[model samples]
Every structure is written in C-alpha cells, then in structure tokens.
Target chain A: MTALSSPATPWKPSVLRLGLHRAALEIKLFNRDVLSLVLVLFFPILMLSLFGTVFGDEPVFGADPSGQGGITPAHYYLPGMLALSTILSGFQNLSSYVATERFNGTVKRLAGTPLPAASYFLGKTGQTLYLIVAQTALLLLAARFLFNVPMPDEPGQWALVAGLMVLSTAAWATVAIAFTALPKSAQSASTLAVLPVLLLSFTSGVYFPFSQLPDWLQSVTNFFPLRWTAGAFRSVFLPPQFAAAEPGGSYGVGTAFVVLAVWVVAGAVLARLAFKWPPQK
Target chain B: MRTPAPGSAADAITVRDLRKTYRLPKGGTLAAVDGLDLAIGAGETYALLGPNGAGKSTTIEILEGHRRADSGDIRVLGTPPWKAAPAFRARIGIVLQEATDSGELRVSEALGSLARCFPAPRPVAEVIAAVGLDGKESVRISTLSGGQRRRLDVALGIIGNPEVLFLDEPTTGFDPAARRQFWELIRSLGEGGTTIVLTTHYLDEAEQLADRIGVINQGRLIAEGTPADIGGPELRIPRVRWRDAAGHHEETTASPAALIRDISDGGRREPLDLAVVRPSLEDIYLQLIDSNRQEPALTGARP
Candidate 1:
C-alpha cells in the first residue's frame, strides 16, 4: 500500500516559466500551420490590391481635389489593411485556437496541471503579438515596394500608431477569448467569430471609405470596434487637411482609444467569469 | 522542506460520501457520481472496473482535480484535489483516454514542454525510452500511429515522476500485443513504488494489473476486493465433463477433481474426452453484474 506522501520541498512554480512554456507550444503550432500563416500575411494585401485597382482614379468620399490628388490609391488603402491585420490577429486567431484546443481535450489535459489560467492567456497574447508584428511588416513592405506608397514623415506618429495597434489587438483578443468560451464546439466558434469580422470589415470601410455608405449603415457600423480602429489608423497616416475626406473628420482617436480600453476590461471580466479550463460537466 | 512522516495506513485516499451532479443544457440535473465512499491503501494498484456510464470516469476526474464534486469530504494525498493547489498537483499525474491534438510538435518537444511544470521531472530521453518511443523522439505527433500516440500519452503522464498516476481507460483501443506491452509498462511503474489508479472494462486487464479491484455500477461502487477474494474461493465452481456408460455426457461439480475421481470408480479405464475447467475472471464478473442487476436496490453490499 502506498502512503500519502507530502512534498519534500515547498511547491513554488514561476508564472513566467508557465507562460514561456505555453508560448513555445503556441508558436510551434502556428508555424506548422502553413495555411493559417499564408492567410494571415496575404489576406489583407490581396484585399487592398483588389480594391485599389477597382477604385482607381475615382474621387473617394468627395475630399478636396488638392489633398485628394496627392494621395494614391495604395495610400488610401494602407491604413485599412493594417486595421484588417489587427482584426485577424485578435478575432480569427484567438477564437479558432481556443475552440480547437477545447474540442480536442487539450484544454482538459492542461487543466490537470499546476499551471494557472493567467499563464495560458499570457502565452496566447504573446503568439497574437508575434502574428500582428509579422502581418504589419508584410503589409508595409508590400505597400512600399509594389505600390510606391509614401512613408510617414514623423516617427512619433508611427510610434503612437504602433502603440495603439497593440492595445486594440489585445482588447479584441480578450473579446475573442470570451466569445470562444461560450461555443460548444470548434465548428460553431469558427463560424461565429469569422462572420462578424467579415461583416464589420465590409461595412466599416476596409475596402472603401465609410462616407460612401448610407446614413443608417453608418450608424450601425459606428457601434463596432472595426470602424474606430480604421478611423484611428487613418488619423495617424493621413495628413490633417485630408480629414475632410473621411466621414468623421480627425478620427476621434481619443474616443476610439477609450472605447477599446473599455472593451478590453469588459472582455477580461467576461472571460474570467465564463471561460472553462476543461469545460463543465 | 522536509517530507512529512507517513500517516495512518488508512490515509492513501479517503472519501466520505462523495457526490457530483451537473445541470444539463435542457434544465435538469444529472448525478454523475452519487454518494460514494472509497479508500485505497499505501502501495496499492487499485482498478475501478465498470462499463460505460458507470460513473467511473466521473469519480476519477474528481480525484484528479479536473472537476469539482457537489458534495463530499475527500482527501487525496491529504488535500482536496479540486482545490487544485500547486503542491497537491505536483505529486499526481493523469493519462486521459483521448490523445492530445498538439499538431506537428515532435514527441520530445511535447514532453519537454510538459516537463517545465514539475519541480523534478524525469529526463526527457529516459521517459521516451520507458514508453517505447525511444528512436521516434523526433517524429511529429501528427504522424504517430494510434498505439504510438497512446504510448506518448503515458509518457507525458509519468514525466513528472508522480507518486500517484491516474490512467482512465488506458488500453481502450490497443491490439492484443500492444495491450500486453502496456501491461508490462504499468507493472514496471507499479514495481517502482508508484501507486496506480486505473479504470477499465476489460476483466482480464483488472485481473492482471490490479492488486485490488473495485467495480462500480450506476453511480455507486457495487463490489471491491482482490480478484480472488472478490469471487469467494468456495464460489469458484468448476465444470466437469465425462461420458456415461450409455454414451450420454454428464457434468456437475463444485470440485471437479473429486467428481472425476468418483467417475473413474477407483480404477483406470480409457479417457472419455473428459475435462475440468475453473471459473475465469470474466465469468465471476458477469455473475456479479448479473446479481447486482437482479437486485437493484441492494444497498451497502461489498464483495
């Protein structure tokens, strides 16, 4: 008969060790999935290229001729593509991974371990950040080399945009985590998560200016995170005078940042309350 | 940090009135594990023997700290498993029935990642060798065969040098040869002083691996003991077959040896295709299950 043996030493596990271990697993899985890599990197680039060619030489959203004439189609599409990349990093990636892991009992297996829930999320965030950075680099290179788009003159504006991008992606990733927790299966998660992103991208002006949309559509689109993200990105890249070209001139960067922050906190709370480590029952 | 002195012999695992119930999506509660009490002693390899929907898996899950119980006073290694403290988890390992879909990660890579969770995990190469995946360490998980994947599952379960290992239907889909190999692996682990808790529907598996066996039916433990003790020695009726003078076969006996002696009439003649057969573990299990089914409300009956 085996006796109940106590630990010979006090048990103390580092959260950093747990996070790093999970991150390594996540990165390995992401790299091995060739299809997912291609979609994340090139999907936005393809969308931008198609829209730029189709809408060439047109007066987009009725901006002043002086400011509008100087901007190329690529320049107009670049910010939207960046916003698209952020959405993919958060909603598409997080939801699918969570759903698949849950379906296959990987999460159940992990729940038996000593690792904490926070460490798992930290690892997922690390993977999301890596994908977003890769997507950003690919979009920028394609914009500069293939379309001859002008680079931002002020490095400070670029820094601010980069910071906001990280914040927004983290916020959206939280929302994805919360949403995925409610799904019963991987199939449901993929459909539920991907459809909303696709719909929002279309209505929130990823392919065309929001001003082209009618009043009712604009009001509905404004309630979503995609519109604010696109508007914020545009504010950083476009000149001050070009604000007249956009629906809500100047982008309301402050309000956009605040709303995204609120979503992040709310999403985190929801995830904590509802997320199942190995699922219930 | 010094190890605590070994406590009472009754302290391996102690449960008093353990119960678990869950709410169904359509709105009623399902009692996965009803009020149950069980205890395993030190150095014991105990098997929870039952068929599907017998609540064996639910009981094991609660003990493994993966699920919470609705009502119970349970102590595993002197701590409530569902509390899920790092200290409590460190001494236990679990091998779930399903293989993890880790995708494209090499066998060694997955084990290496899991090793970080423990304070003193076994060497990665040693664990790989123990599970019989020695030369296939570099092979990705996606390419492994079903049996090989199951071996990998065992490898991960023991990498932490856990004192107690829970194996939930470990050989569900294994071939005969693979099952034998797994049995040998389990034997060696048990010989090394690790207490093992296994669940299986295979009667032969329980007979072979368990020092003590427990059979759960519905949401309760119906019978428990060493295999021999489970079906009493006197209850092991043998089959006796012999031809009569008129060429009609006859067979009846509690002791076939005695019956054969009486049939021979104290003098040797020609053998008549006679045979003596002892009751097997499967026969005993079926008899117990049948009796349990016959009396549905029999409470507190222990084999």
Candidate 2:
C-alpha cells in the first residue's frame, strides 16, 4: 500500500473524509463478523427452503373469485422472499452489528480517532449496500434457476423493482442504525428489532398472501413498509391487469413505490439525528 | 525560547483550563475533569499520575478528541481536539484502553488496513518490528497473548508516525519483563521526537519515563514538576537504622548523619549495622495523595 506523505498544504479534516474512512472500516469489520456471514447468506437460504416447501402448492391468495389461479404461488412468494432477504441484510444485520460494536467499545475507539460520525455511518451504509446487493443477486439466481420462476417481462419494470429493493433496504438500514443507537444493549436491540421484523413478516404477507388474512389484520399490515415493498415487487412480475381482478381492488404500484420511498427518506433523516457513533455515558 | 522549525521539536499539545462533566441518570452531576491545565512540548514524555477514577482517562480522551470538554481552551497541534481536524489527528496517535477485536484478521492484514487511513503511516513491517512482533505478523489477533495484544495496540497507535501519542495504561496487564520492554519502546519513541502523554497506575513507570509528572486527584491537578522537585529530596529526610551497643534494634532520623554519629560514639566492639534511607518516588506519591485526600479543596491548588 502506498502512503501519502504529510501534504505541504495542511488538509482540514472534513466530515466527508471521516465518513469515507468510517465506511471503509465498517465494511472491513463487518466482513470479519461470523454471525453476519451466517445471517446474510445462510439464514436467507434456510428461510426460503422452509417457506417454499410448506406453502408450495396453495395459490398464494387462493383461487381468485374468477375460479382460476392467477399466478403460481411460488412465483408471487419468490419476490416477497427476495424482499425479506434484502430487509434482513439491511435492518437485522445493521442493527445487530451496531449494537455489538457499541457493546464491545469498538464504536468508542473509533470516535476517539479523527474520523467523524458521518464518515462512520457512510462507511456502514456502503457495507450494507454491498451485502444487500450480493444477497439479492443470490436470491434472484435461486428463484430463477432452482425454483424455475420467470423473470419480469419488461426491462422497465425490472429496473423499477431493483430501484425499490435498493432504496427500501437502504432506508431500512438507516432505521435499524437509529434503533441500534437508541437501545442500551445488544440483547435489547436484538429483541426490539428482530421480534418486530419477524412479526411484520408474518403479518405483511411475505410467507403467505395478504388476501387470505382477516380484515383488521390486513388493515394493520397495509401500514407497514414490507407490505408495500412486496406489493411493488409483485407488480413487476404479475400481469398489470391482475390488480383490477383483486377482492379489495388492484394494489397501486405507484402508491407502493411512494410509501417505500417516503419510509426510506424518513429513516435516513431519523438515522442522521438519532444515530450515535459512540454510546454516551 | 527559540521556536523549533515546522514539525520539529515544539509544543505539540497545549491545554488550558479543560473541564468535562458527566450528568448522572438521576439529577446530580459528576465532574470527571475539573479545570485542568497542561502543556506538552514536542518530543517530551509527560505522565499524568492519578489513582483510579482520578479523571486521567477523561483528560486523555479530551486530548484525543474522543470526548468533548464541558468548557476550556484547548489546542492539540494548533487545533481544538474536539474539533478533530484531520491535520490535527494526523499528527497524534492514541492507544485505547481496550483493543478492537477484528476477528480472523491476521496482524499484518489488520495493520495494513489501519495504515490506509493515515496519509503517512509507517511500513507495516517496521511497525511490527518496533512493537517487537516481527515474527507474529501472520498470526491472528484472537490467538495472541495478552502482552502481545498490548504490543499490537501500540503498533497500531504508532503506525501513523504521529508527532504526539496518547497511551492509556499501555502496560497494565504485562509481566515485569514485558512492562520493561514496553517502557524501552516508549523511551525510543520519545527519543525520536514524538510527544507522549501517558497515564499509568505504576509510579515506577512514570519515574522511569516522564521528564515531567503531574499528579491529579479529584479532577484537579495537585502538583506538576520534575520527579525530584515536586517532592523535594531535602524534604525526604533519610531514616537511620542501627543496632546499638546494647544489641537493641533502634531506628531514628532527624538527620541520619547525626544519628549515626551518636550510635558510633556509644559503640561497642561489634560493628553496628547502620543504613540511611531516603524516600522513593512511591513514598512521595503516597504522601501527595494522602495530603490531597485530607483537604479536598486544596487538591487543585498547585504546589
């Protein structure tokens, strides 16, 4: 590695430099965590096998009122599983990593250095992006090759879904980081973030379709980012006219996109305000 | 005093009336660092001597820009540390109390990555050699012994070739030999024009390395001077011990010379065992802390 000599022109420490350095360190450190490796890769594969087999034959929303199955249950569930994979990569992975780093005093060590909080979070964000992209690709490949799921027909729709996945995950990662900052301990953080996400996954129609759920439960699920993300993802693969054939009505692709985007922005803002690079006394 | 050329021997750290306090969860406040003043010149090795909870770490953390002071004027390499300018940080190195556990990463790989953060970091091999870990570069950090891990901590601290270094209990867990070796490493770094601020519970370590020592108690500096001057050698009266002619053990001191002379005047045939003992640095430190504890308000008053 080449070392830069002390510049004759003194360089003022910029927030950007700290952020970049932090991101680099976070990436390096996260890659070394054994739990992170298992969660990002192994956990998703395990979840896919469990859900794919149990709910395999049943039409996801069960035969439409027209007395015909609109799409294979595997096809609809694959996208939701992929979204779930992305969510885990972002929210679960980031929250736990932050909490653990805080507990271990690694975050305190870094704070003492020249690196600023912004640089650290930026580095963390970079790492999360890298992990999420890799996990998403693997999930997509499995869906395509192993499950024999068809790819989205239109290139535009595919782009939209990809954008949504990246944005929604990035947003969730920020929220997770903020949550990690709030929780006092790693155990608390895991319980607070993991339990809620698991609960949401069940209710938001990731493992099973939303149409089969009771009215009040469906109403609560609609408020969650997972529901919209899954809805947006399904819109990309399912027939455009399929929305008009639904019981309550067609899921609005545009509305789902907007909600996910808003959550992402809100999460980023909250993370900026609440995220503590190092725990306070 | 002549100002040293740029980046040469000069004042590397200047802190004035630095203060930091922690607000308790309930309603009270804990003052960790009360108005403290210190200035460390370039290439000088200074030790901040204090007992546990004496605010040594808090002071060091403020200097390192890790914790913001409640109020004070401070400048490290000509910039406020809490501002934490890259230029300021580039010139200073810090070895934290605990080492980061970047698991499964070999020593070489870990140092190599940290080196990238600095604009001008030393060669990884050189750093390893300096810390006396040349042969174990390939070994994972998890597998290293306690002493070796501490050495690695120092290695990472100095990899950036910092003009000033902050070491917080750098040799706490080391055996005597390892501690001595670590002391020698610190001496060499000081010799090479690196301003060093060290905090340790070991009085011997401070006496062995510090050109100037400052004693802090209850968040205030009680004394700041060279080892000899802070507690005057004259004030350390020698104790005279001897076996009198009657074969009775006797120890007396107002002046050891006078006491020895009196014992010799009443001497018998047998040669008397006589010795004069002056106070060690440990004795002086104890006296200082004892006096400080007795009068809390006077603890901050400079001697």
Candidate 3:
C-alpha cells in the first residue's frame, strides 16, 4: 500500500476553541431557521404592541381605585412580556434545538468525534447566552419605542434587571437541557416542552397578574422560578404605584434573588444528572 | 473456527472474548455480543457480514467506543477503544447506520465544521470533490437526495484523513449507480492504505470490497475467510445440470469436468442444457446462515 500523504498537522485545539467553533456553527444554522428566529426576536414585541393597543388605560377595581393616575395595559404587560421572551429563548428554543439534533443523529455523529463532553455543552450554552442577550436588548428596545415604556430610571434598578436576566437565562437554559434528557424523541420533546413553559408563564404572571389569582394559586406559583423572574422585571419596568398590585405590595427583591439562585443550582444539578450525549437508547 | 489473539499490536484491529448484554425493558437480560474474536491486518478492507438481529452492530459499536462492553478485549490501531483518548479518536472515522442530518447546514459547512474536530484534516474542498459532491457543496443538507446525503456522510468521514474508517451499512439507501460510485470511492481509500472496516448484509458488496470477510450470526463468529472460500472449500460443490431424452437431472460433484466426461462416454456426444453451476458469494452466504438456523444455539447459550 502506498503511504497516505498527510497534511501538516495543526496544534491540538483546546476545549474552549472547540466549543467556540461549535457555537459559531450552531448560531449560523439557527439564523437560517426563519420561524425560530422570528419567534425569538419579534414575537414578544408583537404581543406587547397588540395588547397595548387594545387594552384601555382605565384602572381596574383593586389595582388602582383612583382612575386619574391609572396606567395603560401596555405599561402593565411589558414586564410579563420580557419574562416571556426569556422563557422563549432559554427554555423553548434551546430544548427544541437539542432534541431535533438528537433525533436527527447529529449528536451521535458528533459524539463519535474527538470533541469533548464539556465542549459540546459549553458550545450549546454559549449559543443560548448569545441569543438571550440579543433577545433582551431587542425586547427592551421595542418596549421603549413601540409602547413608550421607560428604561430603568435608577442604576440600582438597571442592576436588578441585568442580574435577573442573567440568572433567568442561565437557569432556564439549564432547565431546557434537563427537559431534552426526558423525551424519547425530538417530536415529543418539542411538544412536551410547551406544556411546562405555558403552565409556568400563565401561573407565574407572564400572561396575567399573579396577585389577582386565588390565594392558593398564588402560593403555588411562588415555588417556581418564572413568577420570581416576572416579579423582578416588574420591579424595574413598572412604576412604584404598580407595587401595590404585587404579591407583598413590593418587588419581593430578596425572595426573587434567592428563588432564582436556588433554581439555577437545582437546574444545573438536574442537567448534570439527566443530560446524555447522543441521547439515551 | 480460527480465532485471533486479543490485542495483537501488529494488526489494525484485534478482538477476543467480546461480550455485551442488554437488560430487557419488560424482563430478563439479552446478550447482544457473545464471546467473539476477530483480526484484520493493517491496510486491509475487512467486511463484517451478518443478518439484522446478528451482533455485527454491537461489535462495531464496542470497537467504535460508542458503547461499553460487559467484558471483552479490543485493540484498534494499538489502543483499547473503550478507554481511548482524544488522540485515539482523531485517528479514526465512523459512518453510522443512520446518516446524520444537519438540515440547515450547507454541504461544505457540515464537512468543514466536522474537520475542525481533528488535529490534521484534509481540505474541505478536496473531500467534497472526492465524494463527487462538488456541484452540491452550497446546497443545504435537507435539500440533498438520500444518495447525496450518504455521499456527504462519506465526505465527512474521510475529511479527517483517518487511519481506520468504520462504515456501518454505508450504502443501505443508495441506488445501484450510487452504490457503485460509493464502492469506487471506498476502493480508492483502501488504495491509500487506510484500514477499512465495513459492515453490510450485502454479500456482493463483501465480494467486491473485502480482502477478508467475517460472517457473524446470533452473537457468534460462525464463519471467516476470503470471499472465495467463505464457507470452507470442503463443502463447496459445483452442481452439474443436464437434460436427456427422459428428463432433467442434477448432481453435486467435486469435479464437473469428470461428470461431463462420464456423460459423454455413455454415448451422448453432448448433453442438452448441460451447465456447471458455480455458487456465487450470495449463495454461500445464504447457505451458511440457513444451516446455522437449523441447529440453533444451545439452550443455555445466549444468541
């Protein structure tokens, strides 16, 4: 047999370099998916505009008894929309991407390569982080211009929103990985992911006021991360008067931070235990 | 059967006493790979042939480092694959039974991305041309035909310039033309001294591509040899068929020439419809598998 003339070998790539390459490829492929891109970038803003245009500025019975200073529904719903955008990108988008790759055998093919386990995960997480950041900026910009929603007036409030965005993205992204680990196929994972996202968003105040729900229901919502995330956003986006309508007549800043932190830890652990490369048999 | 020693550094691949069992979802366990041994020399194209439920895939998976074996000794290119490192993986390429579908990625993009996973990779353009996908390089994977996708899978497998390439039923969905084209590509790769390990149920594919063939059945290594001597030379009898005034007659003989001479001596100058029937690789393969089924594995022994 003749000798195979090998090309000059490059230096062994580090795990970080491998991960960055994978992330770049992931983002390129994701950009080509028009439906998912539209959902991630514009769906929340569109919903915000629709609701703002339709719902009147009239004060509700308990939210504001004095009708003179009542806020419009646009301002009231902006915080919830922001939370929804985070969930859309972090949980729904990430999980579906993973599940589809698994079902199509992309994950198995990659597993057979020299790529490390850490690189595969870090690459996916990096893709989600980039998307969430872009999503946050786009949502906030649309809110400010399209609906006249104000930016955070205080640096402390800005700090609060940024902190919450990071925590929520990391937590939900981890939760999504765990979700992919449970489904037997990509179709099931995509269909099943919607259930928890919808359930969490509805009960956690992304679609309605958490305080207005039955007391028992509010108590149930308290255990989840989305309620705390939405409440944290409302603390920064809504005016001080809106605090009266919140569960404790305040932002619950201490509880929100603690709850999100616990979820981050719990989600990371669950992902560690559940996530399988190439997926389970 | 002739069994090879485990972990022979000289050969590209060596296996011995390889065994793996899977727990049934409903009840008892099932052994997927029983005690089996095999060896393929460096720079040789060795085909592993078997039926659907045979242990061919399980054996390949164990060798590919994708699945763990309950107990076995396997050495591929001087390393035990189960505990192999990144460098070990870089030297090998695998095309699984199911072709990976990265639908949104273009053909070049898919191969280019995978190439980055290896330390020394062939240029993406060269691999694309090698697999005859130059015209479809910019097309998205989803738009490619099944045969085109399979060609791309082969492109990705070779882009790393691996020393050993494992192809599991690589041409399962290819049309006749595509299958022949694939065979040419594989033959070219073998010429370059890459050790090719191919698993397929297609006997003709084995005859055309393999220098040596191993037929695995029911988790056991039942037959192993070159394509011409697969079932052993002793059992391979050429059949003599002839038509006389009365009726047609058939007989299996060690020498067809001797039979023809004897028939001629009986006063018929030429026997009508006389022909020597030589069994093709497919016939031998079917006979070997069929015979094994008649006497199933021992009751206590696992398949």
Candidate 4:
C-alpha cells in the first residue's frame, strides 16, 4: 500500500517529453493500417513506376528533336512524384488517419486523458515528417533503379529539395488536420481528402508537364501551393534552361517558398479552429 | 444515504443549476441538461441511470472537460472541469462509449504510451491484469474482440491511477459474461476507495454496482435514491391484475392483497388469471421515463 506516493497534488509531465513518447507511438501505428500505407506510400511510388515505364527514355520537354542533350520524361516526372508524394503523406494520409481516430473515439479518449493537446498535435507533426521523408526516399530509389532517373549534379540542388520538402509537409499536414473536422465520418475521409490532392496534382503538373495544359488551366494553378511545389521540384530536377520554359519563363522558386509558407501559417490557424472529436452531436 | 447540499465538504463532484442547451436544426433549442443539480461524495460509486439522449452522457462529458456547459456551476475534484488544470485531468479517468479508434497498437503499446504521459501511472502490466487483459498484452487491438477492447478502454482510463473515474455506457455492447466480468472489475476498483460515477441505461447494472442511483430523463433527475427505494414509494407500489367478463384490468396499490380480495368479491367469485406482483427495478425505470414524456416539454428555455 505504501510503495508509491499518493497523487494528492497531481503533477504533470513535461509536454516535450510526453510528445516524444506520443510520436513514437504514432510511428508504430503508421504501418498498422493498410489504408494509411496505401495513401501515403504506395500510391505515389506506383504512379512514378507507371509513368516512368510509360514514357521511358523519351525526351519530352526541354529536349531536342533528336532526343539528345535534353532531359528524359522519367527525369522530369521523378521530381513531380516526389512533390506529390510529400503532400500525399502530409495531407491525405494525415486527414484520413485522424478522421478515423475521431470517428472511433480515439480523439475523445485522448482528450479525456492528462496528455496535453499540444503533445497530441506534436505527435501528428512528427508522424507527418516521418511519412514524408520516408515516402520521398523510397519514391526516389524506385525511380532510380526502375527507370534510371539521374540525380542533380550539385549538392545545393539536393539541399533545396530538402527545404521545400519541409515547407510542403508543414503546409499540407496542417491543412489535413483541419480537413478532418470537415468529414462527417471516417468512411468519407478518403474521398474528401484524396479528391482535392488528386485535382491539384493535375493542375500543379504532377500528372503531366505544366506547359502542356490549357492557358486558362495554367492560370488557375497559380492560386495553389502545389503549383509552386511541382515547379520548385522541377527546377532542381531539370536543367536550369528548363526554368525558362516555366509559366513565368523562370522557376518562380522564391514565390514557391512564399506560397508554401503562407499555407503553413493559414493551415495552422484553421487546424486550431476546426479540430473536433467524435460524436459531433 | 442523504446527500449533503452542493459545496459541502468531501464531495467529489458537485453541480448547481447545470444546463446545456443545443440549437435544433430547424428552429428551437433542446436543453439536454436543464437546471440539474448533483452532488457525489468521495469514495461513492454513483450510477446515473438514464435512457439514451437523457443528457446523462452530456452531463458526464461536461464533467470530464470534453465539453462546456451552456450554464452551470459545476465542479469535479473541487474545480470546474472546463477551467481545471492538468492536475484535474490527472486525478480523473474517463471511459467513453467507443474505445480508441485505431486497432494498430498492441495492448501493451497503447497502455504503455499513454502511461508515459502521466506522472505516476499504474504499471502497464498491472492495468492490463486489472482489466483481465493479461495474456492478450501482445495482441493487436484490432484483433481483440469488442469486449477485450472495452477492457483495454478501462485499462487506459485507470492507468493514470486516477482518484475519480467516469464510465459512460461502459458495457453497452457486452455479452452477459463480459458484462458481469466488467462489473467485477469495477466493483474491485470501488472497493479500493476510488470515487466512481458511471452512466448506464441498464437498471440491473445500477442495482448490482451503484451505492446510489439517480434516474435522469429529459435532462433532469427524476429520482435519486438507493436502488431498493428508487422512484419513491409511489413508483414502487405493487400491482394486482385479473381478467373479468368485461375485460382485463389492473390496479396499483400499496396493499396488493386487499386489492385482490376486492377484485375477487370477498371469495364469492374468483377473478380469472388473477395475479399480484411486486414491481422490479426495471418497471420503476420504465415508468419513470414514461412519466416524463407526459410532462410539458417547455422549460422556458432561453435562446
């Protein structure tokens, strides 16, 4: 009876410490759901494999008619896959996972616990980064071995890719967290979340080159963060001259940074406002 | 036992004029809890028995800090839950109607991760054992049956070594065996002097476990007392029934024998299919909720 001290004046653990524990739990749970794995990992890798095989070794854009001294379609589409994978991991996977949790009463149970809300969210943040980084690495490896997509020559190009990865993860993860509140049930989470990402990936040029789209469609893509994401990624993967072939005749890298950062801030605010537990009534 | 008024000493939870009103979709408001008052003393196992949508869950959720009351003076562990500190949450454990959403983690994994968040949690092994989840510790939550998941839910709730525990419809989908097993687990916890407040529509469950029962209907406490004496003397009166040439008839009375004699006309004639029976707790509960339906709906609720 006397082994442990009584909880007379209840003490709280540090949020940072608990948050790490939560993150660990989150990572373990990541692979447990088949749907989650498909949403974040398989969909993009499969897309890359299919696209690279379909357009193998063919110099599509920024290539000479002789198909020499220019980028292959595989190389061009590889970066788009990376950008698309990052958002899929960050947004689509996150929304569906949390929506299921809410519908199943996991969120409600956690809210009743002593765990700080910040710690719960911190765990989600950790899960998003882990998924994005893991999915990107795997997608890139598949592209190289499967299609022989070449890497950028400069180390600085790789660093830029990493930075954009961070921005995109933050922007889309927060938006997905907010989006969970919009779905009335877990069944709708997949459709509601994936539809927008699928649409934007088209408008943002993940499905094909931005220059191939209609003029009106090109202008419409300007309003989305993915537009910047796909462009920034292309700037790194393709030769610098290809930047001139972009919508603005340049990579628009600075604007890419700005758009993604804006989404990061706005998404954070909306997530705070819209987060809900199960049994909405 | 008599409950001291709200704000009295040693009360684990107290509510004065608590009200929660929700806006109806078309036009109007439903006062889920309207001017309800409650007081539960420390170490008491109080069962709030109510039908669905009676505001029992609503009241408990408000007490659990998951929702805010539209208007009320409420306190759990001497602090209003909405404004309470982290310590407030630490001192209280909650079992929701549905358990955790994900079935991804093993039993040990889910309990261990949550246990780390508390300053002094019950050992994961101990919680699992307490909830009768010993051999299943390594099993994934999804693989466990519904009853096992509920035991895990209780394990999560009590892992914090909470001073007070709130169980909201904790045994809703359980089989007879599982329900009885859950009652044993709860009874053991109550014996350890933990303050337990549970909500269930099952009257027999209240009779088996609760030290006191409060019957809530239409968001108000219709009756509060020991299970044997609940619904007051009037609701507990015995009934006599018989069939005559005219038709089947039933009569309620404190003295069923006298009523039976009158119906049989002093033994000169027998009332066909005559029977006298004492009302069970279930009867009292049904009558209680039914009586509430006949009452006026308007509570002068403010917009």
Per-model chain A TM: 0.89, 0.83, 0.90, 0.90
- lDDT tens digits, residue span B141-248, model 1: 889988999999999899988988999999988999999999999999988878889999899999999988888877788877787777566447777766766785
For candidate 4, the docking band is medium
What tens-digit string does per-residue lDDT give for candidate 4 at B1-303?
A: 344544679899999889999999999999899888888988889999888888999999998988888998898988899846677788999888776565778889888887876778999998998999989989988899989989998999999999899999999889999999999999999989889999997888999999888887788887787788887788778888899999998888898888777777888889999988789999988977786777555222211
lDDT of 2 at A80: 74
Q: Which CAPRI tier for candidate 2?
A: acceptable
* lDDT string, candidate 3, A13-91, tens digits: 5799989988888888778889888777577877887887678544442353455556567777888887887788889
For lDDT, the strongest prediction is: 4
Whole-model lDDT values for every prediction: 0.81, 0.77, 0.82, 0.83
Q: Give lDDT tens digits, candidate 1, residues A160-214.
A: 7788788778888888888877677778877787887889888987777888899
Which model scores highest in TM-score? 3
Which lDDT tens digits does candidate 2 get at residues A1-281?
12366546665456676567666666676677777778665566667666567667455443568867555556667767777876787898888877777876667766655555666677778888878777778777876777667787778977887787787787688778777777777678777778767988887767776677788988887776888777777677666665653336666667777877787888888877776544455
What clash pairs does model 1 have?
Answer: A1-B42, A1-B43, A2-B42, A2-B43
Compute each candidate's TM-score over C-alphas: 0.92, 0.89, 0.94, 0.90
- Stretches of candidate 2 exceeding 4 Å from the true structure: A1-8, A12-34, A55-61, A64-73, A116-119, A239-247, A277-280, B1-9, B243-254, B266-273
Which regions of candidate 1 are displaced past 4 Å? A1-9, A52-70, B1-10, B25-28, B245-252, B267-271
Give each model's clash number.
4, 5, 0, 0
Candidate order (lDDT): 4, 3, 1, 2
* DockQ per candidate: 0.65, 0.41, 0.51, 0.50
Worst 10 residues of 3 chain A by lDDT: A1-10
Residue B127, candidate 1: C-alpha displacement in angstroms: 0.5
Docking class of 3: medium
